[model samples]
Target chain A: MKKFTCIVCPISCSLAVQAEGGGDITVTGSKCDRGKAYAKDEYLAPKRVITTTVKIDGADIALLPVIGTAPVPKELLRTCLRHLYGIKVTAPVRMGDVIERDILGSGVDIVAARSAVIKKG
Target chain B: MREITADIAVVGGGPAGMSAALRACGLGAKTVLIERDAALGGILNQCVHDGFGLLRFKKQMSGSQYAQQFADAVYESSASVMTETTVLKLIPGECGSKAQSRQGLYTTGEKTGGALIRAGAVILAMGCRERPRQQAGIVGSRPAGVLTAGAVQKYINVEGYLPGRKAVILGSGDIGLIMARRMTLEGIDVAGVYEIMPSPGGLRRNVAQCLDDYDIPLRLSSTVTEVHGKKRVEGVTVADVDAARHPIPGTEVFVPCDLLVLSVGLIPENELSRDAGIEMDPVTGGPVLDNFMMASVPGFFAAGNVSAVFDLVDYVSDTGEAAAEGACRFLGGEALPEYVTVRAGDDVSFVLPGKIRRDLPSSALYMRVKRTIENAVLEILADGKPVYEKKHPIVTPPEMVTARFHESAGSGVPDAGGLTVRILGD
Candidate 1:
């Protein structure tokens, strides 16, 4: 039995997961199906989406905020951030522009969180 | 000074200001949004983290992305926006057909010169600011590395600079938890988070994802007693606190760190409101507002963090929309009705819209708890008679509870008696 807090929503349901010999997983205290799915995934192998920034050139700001398009393996968050920190993109980066594809082979693309146009001369 | 005329003048271009300006424009009123920052997104520009706009968009979005949704709409709308503009003063209840004598705002813009913005209604949307170390009451030498979590966020996410390689965060609030994760991801060693209260100040989700997931330590019932640095922060002395939150004598521990981040609390920026002599709420530290988000002064409104510091940006935007709607109503020459006072009762910190008009068909009241409790019932009472009740499995001080009341519900809400929101717990 494992206790987990569901972060799927603001409700923050505390889910109790029970499994015996991996036969079947029973999740309790989740208000919605999304929380159930989150509990199962968290129980099997925890994962999280990385949200951070990367260096950008020719933009008004020095850094361009980015987010992983999907959640990746939780353990690889540090490695993914290391990859993002080294990478730099130019201005004209649009929202959803892929900064890095298949980051750390996690199959999640790092996309720009916001658009940054060229700096005014 | 130059003069600009509009139906509505919105100060601050954050989520609330943008939403208010957009909503006001949608109602066919000429709206002008004035922002102190260079960009229209305001604080959201530096808040690069995800998990925003969950309620409104039904999906987790980065703060910047969430702000962009409204920013894009504002740009497409007819509402005029003035970035890098500072509103010096608000002269409420003074505007009319005449340009010079109109109730208006005195503002100065970096690109555009100082101007008198005459408007039929003014919506104050300036958001809250973080409490610094001095305000947090840490006896320390003035050091360069001590900064608020928001400032560090801007430094890392916007300026691409790391203030320090090692840090100690004070306060277990959401921002502190998020910054702990952020700094850890940026290769900074966070010694641990020291919180004065026994319980975490932020949401449980943040504790689960930001700290627990990252293997960071959350030390409760502890606080930074003293700072030990001169030019730059060298270290801090932390101590465990007793029930009264005073530091225990023998429980002091020295932790070496380059930066000390303060996430103690947020106070609504109400200088303009105070200067205008608006009735203020001693608890919320904002304005005494009515159901329409209208301030004590007629034709003057307060919204978003300027009214109360909200946990979610969604609620902030909601207040902004309400203020805009109220401003539009004021412009339409709606007559003011008798108001019923709304009071905070037992176990509640504060409630927005300090008062509500007696004849209002419906109104939403946002509130927070004084402490955490499970199996509690949130009850709304009118003149000591129960009007509405909701059973909650749990309630925390950090989480806000929103209760909406409709006069047509036949809930026996009186027009003369005041409304009191309280929590019934064992």
Candidate 2:
């Protein structure tokens, strides 16, 4: 049996999972149905990414977020950072504003996490 | 400015607000519920979970079902509910105002603009929100698949879209824990929940119910130090942390995953409250209230999650009732003495009901701890006396500690003294 913890909502469930014969797995201990679903996937595959701010021009603030809308592959973080280093946004950014959709065709969108105004001089 | 008057005005149409309005109307107050949303239910609309009404209803209920019942109860009441209306400000009522009585509200905004409904009382029931990823210092290759736990839940439950198949999550908060199970149910790959604390930030039942039940590994005192990917996420570098919380060298390992969900923590929604000059308690991110749940400004009352994040809906409702009554009592000319003052003590993260009047009955003090302890004693001291103390077999930061007092200790005059809570005998 494998163990996993669901930290989604306040109902953190300590899950117990057992792989059956094939890709099928038995899950228990989830506070809700979502926990079970989380268990099956962890054993099969896992992925995630980092979301942060990038420098912007002609805005009140010098930085805006490029939050990940999807998880990128695990090995190419440095490569992605190099690309972001060369990127910059113009002023008047809104929270949740999409910066790049299907970024690099990774099926993810980089969005602003918070709103910032272009400072009036 | 416009003038309007109601017996009771409840801000926020969430569960607490709706329940408060329903209760107030049932108590013979003509209630008016003002919701900023197009609908009455606030965050509950996005919360599609099932463990919502367990304590309030003594039965299992989905978030939507519980919201419907509360909405129905409010509908049945004589209280008037105005949706998509924002309460911009509160002021002295016209004509009725003099030194003896203060005008309660001069409201402005799209929904209830230019209307002054003299609410005999008011209840503030604003809710909380999630902290974003950038604050967590999760460095990674710029790509996608990172989102707050709440957003993921809303996207799947409300918008009916799948975020991704593979996933990794940072922070083992309740939302993250539950979503782990949620995404997994949709046949998506759920990676793991990582926590920087030695213990889980969520309730123990959640650790047991959500993660333990599903076989998801919880890396305690660990973190997602780096994200790996180019156009998309390919993996994450998770490392164990020592007591100081710095990642232990040589312990770094890479895990491949697609989606990352964060459930770091919640902060009270206080932008409006702050702008209104309400005195706030930094510890709880809420406001300082006397026994009546009234803020520094008269007629400006706060309750429920807006005041502080509550573990159960029952407490939210309980606080909401007090806010309404406090507002009404003030308007009705009931004399409530001012508390000398309130203060937070050592071992105590913070306490609610920051003050109490001499005439007011002793109130409930809600707080949490700074860390975990075994065989701990939570002691409440008033006027330097051991007013109340309780020993628990165990105490953790995630679970809130609640202690109430109804009897006055000495002069019954709060201004004459003060109170403090300390943890001992661990």
Candidate 3:
């Protein structure tokens, strides 16, 4: 048996999960369908979106914030952030511009979360 | 000093200010937005983490993304934006001298010198600031690495630098929890998070996702008592706190860390509002507002953190839109009606829009619970008679709950001299 808190909404339902072997699983204490689905996914293959900053050159700011286009495997978050930190981009980056495609083969693209304009001379 | 005139002048350029400016401008009012920062996004530029805009935009995104959406819209709109400008004073215009009681907004630009913006109405949207070390009651040495969670966020996300390799977070607020994950992801070693209260101060989702996911220990009823080392933070003394939140003398343990991040609490930035003589709510630490977000003074409106410290930015933007509408109406020569007082009853901390007028078809009231309640029923009574009620699975102090009183619910609420918002738990 495992316990989890549903993070899908503000309700924050506490879900109790019972699993038999690796096949049968039962989830209880969810008040809504979304919470139930979240519990199932959380118990199975947990995924999370990554939001981090990467180095940027010739921009007004030293760093540009980025977000993963899709939720990747939870364990791959560090690897994705490390890869993003190692890479640098020039100024004039627009929001939603892809910075890295298929990051760590997680099928998640790292896109610029905010625009970085060129520094004024 | 240079002089500029507009129909409405909005203070602050964060989510609330931007939304208010956009709404006021969209309604064909000449609006001027004044921001203190070089950019219009304000603190959201440092808040790179996701989980924002779920209610406003209907899409969960990063704070920067949420802010940029409004920034882009403001830029595209006809509203005039003045960045890197500081508001010196808010001078109320003489009554009957100008239509709708105009105001003089004295401001100083970064490079363009001083200016006085004369507008018919003003919107106060300056956001809140995090409480610092002194306010948190920690007896510590002055150390270099001691910084607020927001400062650390700025250092890592905006400046691209880590504050320290090992860190100890003092509060379990949402920012502290998020920073624990953020610092850990940035290769910093988070020793643990020590919270003074038995329960966490932030939302449950943050405790699960930020602390639990990272294997970070959250020690409840524990606090950082003292700081050690000089120049930089070398360690901190963690102590077990009693029910009264006093440090137990014999239970002190020293935790070695180079960084101490403080996420104690947030107080609404209301210096301008306070100095302008607007009545404030002692509980909320913001201005006392009517249903339309109007403060005590005529033609002066308050919204966002300046009105109250909202749990979500969506509510902040919501109040911004409402305040803008009120300002527009004031400019259109509409008089404010009499407002009935709304009191916070049993198990309730505080309620916003402390008063409401009878004429509005609907009004939204935001409040927080004094403590945790299971199977909670929120009841709104009009002069001791129940008029509106809502049921919630659970209610906690960390999360703000909202209830709306619509005309469809009942009609006697508007005329009631007093209303009480309370939580009934079974």
- Identify the CAPRI category of the predicted complex in candidate 3: high
What is the iRMSD in Å for candidate 3? 0.8
> RMSD in angstroms, all models?
1.9, 12.7, 1.4
User: What is the TM-score of each candidate's chain B when compared with the real chain B?
Assistant: 0.97, 0.89, 0.98
DockQ of each: 0.72, 0.05, 0.84
Mark the regions of model 1 whose C-alpha exceeds 4 Å error after superposition. A10-13, A16-19, A22-34, B95-101
**Prediction 3: B-chain TM-score:** 0.98
Model 1, span B1-426: residue lDDT tens: 898989899999999999999999999999899998888887889888888898888888999998877888999999999988999999876656553235679999779789999988899999999987778997646978899999988888888788999999999988889899999888899999999999999998999888987789999999999888889999999999999999999999999999999999999999998998898898998999998999988888988988998999999999999999998888888787888888899999888988998787889999989998888898888877887888887889989988897766636656567888999897
Q: After superposition, how far is residue A92 of candidate 2 from its true place, in Å?
A: 43
- Cα lDDT of model 2 by residue, A18-92, tens digit: 888966788888767777777776556644443444677877544554556566763444455456657788878
Tens-place lDDT per residue, model 3, B280-299, is 89999998988888898888
Could you say which candidate leads in lDDT?
Answer: 3
Q: Choose 1 or 3, whichever is better by DockQ.
A: 3
Give lDDT for model 3: 0.89
- Native contact fraction (fnat) of model 3: 0.81
lDDT of 2 by residue, B209-304 (tens): 567656788889999888888877778889999999999999999988877788899888887778767889887899888878888877778888
lDDT of 3 at B371: 97
Of the candidates numbered 1 and 2, which has the greater lDDT value? 1
